[model samples]
Target: MNNQASRSPVFKAMLETEMEESLSDTIKLSDVSHGALCAFVDFLYTAEAPLDDDMACDLLVLANKYEINHLKNYGENFLISKLNWESSLKNYSFAHQHNAKTLLDDALSLILDTMDNLNEREEYLELVEKDPRLVVNIYEAYYSKTGRCCRCHQS
Candidate 1:
């Protein structure tokens, strides 16, 4: 377990440092769910996990946190494969939060493609309320792509 887990830069650093966790037999991760933890450990050992949408999201977070590039890429690819109009906004938000560049780009493309109905979605409203900067980024992407202003729709 130590050998496999050390493949992550986070675990490697933790184990190498003279910190309490380095001397301890058990380490605690409070933020992640039990299932995600298990899957993350399993992936460390086996290089794969049974990825669903929720698991992909969880693993993506974990992988990013731990600097596990392979696992992060795996999770991103899974989510990207499942991208759609209904889930694009939510996925975009998640991708943005996690700094998943490919997933963010893919989700943003979908959101841009469906901008006409963007205001109808509850997620869009929530995102506007919660992270309005992200919404502005959407408009910026639109303007950049189309060479037209978001409000006036003129180049």
Candidate 2:
């Protein structure tokens, strides 16, 4: 593959390097699933890939890892389009982990909008246990959005 076809710096660097994969006829991505690899390759060639709810996150991850800006944006937009209250927390966490700022903001907005019932949800409790900082971030976001501190209503 030539540099003109792909916008990914990772691919450009790999192709330019004297690395074994560059010299060899094959390049193996052990962590990527066959379907994801196929889709990633297809995107590199065509600048497009069919994305479903299940595939979007995976593609986003691959896009991020490979530093494919357009593909990453595509996946982030797809995930944002699919966002809902039920999946907001999970998506928010995924976005944070993946450094998808737009997706993170969108998911955080949904979570904040539903904050009245957030504590009652099992996911909220799980997040509290698994990543308390995320829950703190939610509260901080809430305060930032509302312009009110959590301590203001104290008795």
Q: Write the per-residue lDDT of candidate 1 for residues 1-155, one digit (tens) a residue.
A: 57865678887777778977688945678899999989988898889999999999999999999899999999999999999999999999999999899999999999999989999999999999999999999999989899997788899
Q: Which pairs of residues collide in model 1? A: none
Q: Indicate which candidate wins on lDDT.
A: 1
lDDT (C-alpha) at residue 83 in model 2: 92
- Error in Å for residue 65 of model 2: 0.4
> On a 0 to 100 scale, what is the lDDT of residue 1 in model 1?
51
lDDT of each: 0.91, 0.86
Q: Report how far residue 91 has shifted in candidate 1, in Å.
A: 0.6
Model 2 error, position 121 (Å): 1.0
Worst 10 residues of 1 by lDDT: 19-28
